[model samples]
Target: MHKSYVGRRRKNPARIEMQEGNETPTRDQIESVVSLYNGGELDAAHAATTELIEKFPAASILHNIRGAVNARKGNHEGAAKDFQNAIDTNPAFPDAYNNLGVALKKLGRQQEAIENYRRAVSIKPDYAEAYFNMANALRDLGRQEDAVSNYKQTLRIAPKHNGARNNLGVLLNKLQRYEEAVSQFSAVLLANPNFADAYNNLGLALKNIGREEEALASFAKATEVKPDYAEAHYNKGSYLFDLGRRQEAEASYAEALRLKPDFAEAFRSLGAVKRYEKDDPQIPYIKSLLDRNDISDNDRMHLNYALGKVSEDLGQHREAFTHYQNANFLRKKFLNYTPDLERRLFRMVRESFEDVERIKNIYRAPAEPFRKTPIFVVGMPRSGTSLTEHILASHSQIYGAGELTTFGMAVNSVWSGGEVTAEQLQTIREKYLADMNRRDVAEPFITDKMHLNYRWIGFICMALPGAKIVHIKRRSIASCWSIFKYYFSDFGNGYAYDLDDLGEYYASYMDLMKFWEERFPGAIYNFSYESLTENQEEETRKLLDYLGLDLEQSCIDFHETKRAVATISSMQVRRKLYKGSSEEWRKYENFLKPLIARLGED
Candidate 1:
């Protein structure tokens, strides 16, 4: 949130130093005001600049100096007017325009600020500060790609611009370009080793790329550098929570809340790990936040979700439903979910593989066996995909590779209108296996528990014939209810926020799985979650047999297996199996009539 070129120590102050015109004020008179401004005597600088401006009314430097003083003093409105006056005196003044942009941006006029920044950069193309300011404005206006271009331009002009680099890294992370983000952050930290934000951003990017241990170290470094960084603490807590370190996660969250008491996301994350009792103090605090009008919809959404979690734990089913309903209602505003578009995509997927014989013909086994094989645990969200992966990964020779996007990236690379050529199929196979081979795991089998990989079963069969696909099944009501009640960090699960959308999406998923089953009978191992809970030994034996592996005692002792699980079910998978989860939805059955009706046939 640093302003454009304010506190930077640079030689040759082009923006502040006035030219010696024939009729302008003397150099000594100008220096008197500029010296006060530069010396941090804002009151003296403002008073002296205003007095001199009256004598030399055409002096743009006097106005610019006054604007800089006002900006430093936090009077953006006055600073903007002063910068405007400077621009009027000298219309080609890029500095004044840039300064005006900063002032206007502080006043919440991002579009106008961007316009001023554009004008400044146009007047003087080498104005790196203007470009940096424009990039910040573009990000505020939600023009992320444009912001990135401007940020790159700023760095190109001023390679030592750590602020621009740090912001660019953050924006890249938001765009999910994690590796590029890591590079930017790393470069920033190389020059400025004490840059806390860079360390924090690097941690985020590393986490996204499955470098959890490195990410944790980066987060720790960020906190060590900046002790009061609440967001860093919150992020560390989230990573810990995903790793099933509930106590440590809770402690981190507590530190974050201590630093920033109104941190709604931290509260929501704390609620995720905390099992609430009747008199939990956090309950009233979260409820109090809901009554405050100043809170944002995003904050309100998190607060409501947190309240919902605590209420549900306390058996206040109806109250929890109300909070969840409100939370989802707020959440839906930020998501773009079109049922028809989803339906069309599903239809195309079905049509692409409609020629079952052609699809089967294209399927080819590798010339040599892969030293490492993948076990894809695919299914709907909250349908025990994580649990299945945890169980399978408990084996001595299997490792859990959580929710990898390598296959999806390969699919998107060469997939043309849902069709794939034989060469393209090979390319997909090579790309996917190349990524897998690059992984550091020594295990012969790795479990990829990216639940939505259910969508690409046909491609998986063709490209990775050696891969085992396990389709974990749960009762429809239980699964949909589980999805709707909780929040998914991934935006792809947009359908979960609405009951009707959830039902329709589930129905399509079931239908697609049926089509796959019809085409590739006996290919997918359909594991029943309920059955696994009821008869753990028999069902697990069947699962292991499908993968051609001998039953291990560790599989039965899955709860005791130690590994990092980064799913919502991270905590759940660490405990012993229990039945009756499917029946929990019955408590909210009356309120879920719409969902039930939509899922009637399922």
Candidate 2:
């Protein structure tokens, strides 16, 4: 088992030799002060260190000891000054440098701490603790790659460093290297089976890779190891909800709330699992929390959204809209979004792809054969992309890999410099296929319903001419209003936060889709959401025929298809087709005038 290393102040007994100056404190006096500090006698230690520092005015050891005492007393600034003084007194003392880094990190001077940590490691090449500390500071600065490298170096020096190993797993998970993350987390479990966090992290990695059963087992293991682990319970609930086990998911979420009464995320998840009636007790509880000044901004945002959902369920449309608006306002204040900037981006996209002849002239076919035929479903958010995917996934040979960002990421990678070559396009295709394979896709035709793929249609056609594109169209007002009603957690869709921005974005989306239609004629199959909802059988048949598949009864009975859905429409897609959602925008038409005006519906 890997041993845990608790950081503590250490005094070098061999460094207690007397100096030549008569005014210098005796080695015995310094040793007594160090013992007082290490023994948790902070007040007595501080007094003794101050008196000794006067006698031994040039002793770096005294300053470092005083800094440790100050840090214990929660005086970070004072501790930092004392540590800096120690370093100035003895420039070659590696311990003083490392201690100064610790003090600076506590003061939130991460960049300065990193520099001191670097100095400490340079002075003592085998300083694993210094390397670990430096890695944490780098992570705080969002230099994840550098942090990963430093963590690896720490493990090399101290192979039993479980903390470094666990942190490395977290970084790998953030980088989307799920397989490597699983391995790192598994190593931590092998060393200590009782590590609940490792189990939780392993579950997330497993879930990302489509190992649903294994992921559930990991989450269950985490909860078993720590019964009161609120986060683990919440994660388990999320997975269960995605898997369509609503009752079990509700239990998990409720348990999380019982353990941590103020757990906002768990409350939100519970609200989503089951709709609340007009007099539901949870609604009032959430409202009371909103009245408190002690709750964090993030919690307040969640509570407001929860209240909005409940109000909407109770048919209080005006109250619901107000709550949704307030919630989005709070969230948007922290996001970096500019409607004009997004407008310029849309213009750039149209300009880049509007010239069909220019695009064809520059396009080159890859030498490798594009074997897989990806059916990409792209459109504005809340435009029935999930419903379309659910219907098509009912076909035996059509796998629904929901909302893939791989193609968008690949396009960004290839086009970051200049024109993409045929070989580069082939590499992008291979990368996309590799990602699909990672998701356990094995069917001949698969649906990639990443709605934002609308922006990359030209690139999609250029890279894979054999791919089929399905553009789901909804009424602009309905789409924009639906976007406004929900809180999109992804900052990439920040335009949804405001009515005017939502309207402008919808307009830009239509313009780009028009450009794609003109640029790649006959390549896209435009499907209307309202038309499909009104004519399910006819539309389902048309969609299956487009994919070259036989008319299967399951396609029309798509509501019965069991699969993991991770979108807001997860519940909606599981129900039979209905027409009520088509005209929902009419209820809040007055509040939606700004969006209507921007979408040119006025």
Best by TM-score: 2
TM-score of each: 0.77, 0.85
Clashing pairs for model 2 are none
Clashes of 2: 0
Overall local distance difference test of candidate 2: 0.80
Of candidate 2, the 10-residue stretch with the lowest lDDT total is 1-10
Please estimate how well model 1 matches the true structure, expressed as its whole-model Cα lDDT: 0.85
Q: What digit string (tens of lDDT, one per residue) describes model 1 on residues 1-602?
A: 01011113233222564677755789999888888887889899899889888898888888888888898888989999999998998999899999899899989999999999899989999999999889988987878889999999999999999888888988887765677899999999999898887888888778767788999999899889999988888888888877788899999899999999999888888888889998888788888899999999989998988998998999999999999989988888877666887787788778888886786676675777876899999999888999999999899989888788778767767874565568778888998888778777789998888888888898898778768999999999999989888887766888888888788899999999999998778789999999998999999999999998999999999989877777789899889999898888999988998888888833
CA lDDT, every model vs. true structure = 0.85, 0.80
Using lDDT, give the best candidate's number: 1
